[model samples]
Target: MRFRKTGAPISFIIPSGNLGNGVAALWTKKMGLPIQQVHFAHNANHAVVDYLNSGDYEPSDTISTLANAMDVGAPSNVERLKALYPDFSLLKRDVAATSVNDASIQNAIRKSEKHWGQIICPHTATAATVREQIGESTNEWVLVSTAHPAKFETIVEPLIGKPVEVPAPLKAILLNPSQSQNISPNLLELLDALSGPKV
Candidate 1:
């Protein structure tokens, strides 16, 4: 609706690992937006890179990375990806997906702070790096920065060499008394922890 007013073509460059936000953009495309394409930016763990480049969409174990939330090996929205573009060639044409490593992510953060004077999260940094790699384009790309910098202060602050002020709500929550229970990565351990009997 908004774009209809402006008369400009829209493109989305999203930091994707799970493909949820990408799917949302697809939905917008379904709604008849002039969606040029959607770019998926992954960090080190290039789980979906093969699917985009080739026609093979396989599931792999997600490796731990800076953008941990986007660490989905078997992206749940892949079916949507297939449904959107049943043909590999069409998928390749419409969707551009790539990977960025930890080093590149850090570099993006530093460069953005130095040049743009804005600090972005590791996940968002992935999109920034991909944007740079793609070079100049006539279309304006909207990068979907999934998380705020405040949420990833430890990761963002060190990379940018600056202090990120914690927001009021997060600060209050952090100031309050909170307890966390560490549990091994198993259902039994989780069950025991939830049951209040530490084994």
Candidate 2:
């Protein structure tokens, strides 16, 4: 959409958990979009970065981080990426991967509020940190903001020293009652829960 609007090639720094969004960006580029590059931003669980550094794909146990949504170590979309770009060099060319630690994420959150006056969530901070490390580049970099800062107030508020105002839509949704089902870590339990009576 940015390409359609600006008619200029742009690059994206996506916050990825299971490589789903990053792979979709690659497909968008493959379909002849004017995307110059697609960069994957990950938290401590950086399986994609591991694969990019080494020509091997290995899934590890996920590490808990501020970016809880992006704490996926076994990214499901890696096979799709491999299918899209079979050659390792081609894959490397199409995608850039980086990992940000908890300290970096916190620092990025602070820097964002200080510089841009934007209180970004930890997931977005991952991409912001990568963008900061890259310095200024000719390519237009879009850091994908996955979630609102209000969703992570426990983490964001203390860092920014203020309350992140929840948007109207989010506030309305929050007013509605939330429902959840707790099940065991077994397949049958999940199946039973899924097939159980509707609330």
Candidate achieving the largest TM-score: 2
Compared with the true structure, what per-residue lDDT tens digits does model 1 show for residues 52-99? 766787888888888888877888889988888787787777788989
- Residue ranges of candidate 1 with Cα displaced over 4 Å: 176-199
Q: What is the C-alpha lDDT of each candidate?
A: 0.85, 0.92
User: What's the true lDDT of residue 12 in model 2?
Assistant: 96
RMSD of each: 4.4, 3.1
Name the weakest run of 10 consecutive residues (lDDT summed) in model 1.
190-199
For model 2, residues 148-197, the per-residue Cα lDDT tens digits are 99999999999999999999999999999888998879999899888978
Colliding residue pairs in candidate 2: none
Position 64, candidate 1: lDDT = 85
For model 2, the superposed segments whose C-alpha errors exceed 4 Å read 1-7, 180-199
- Candidate maximizing lDDT: 2
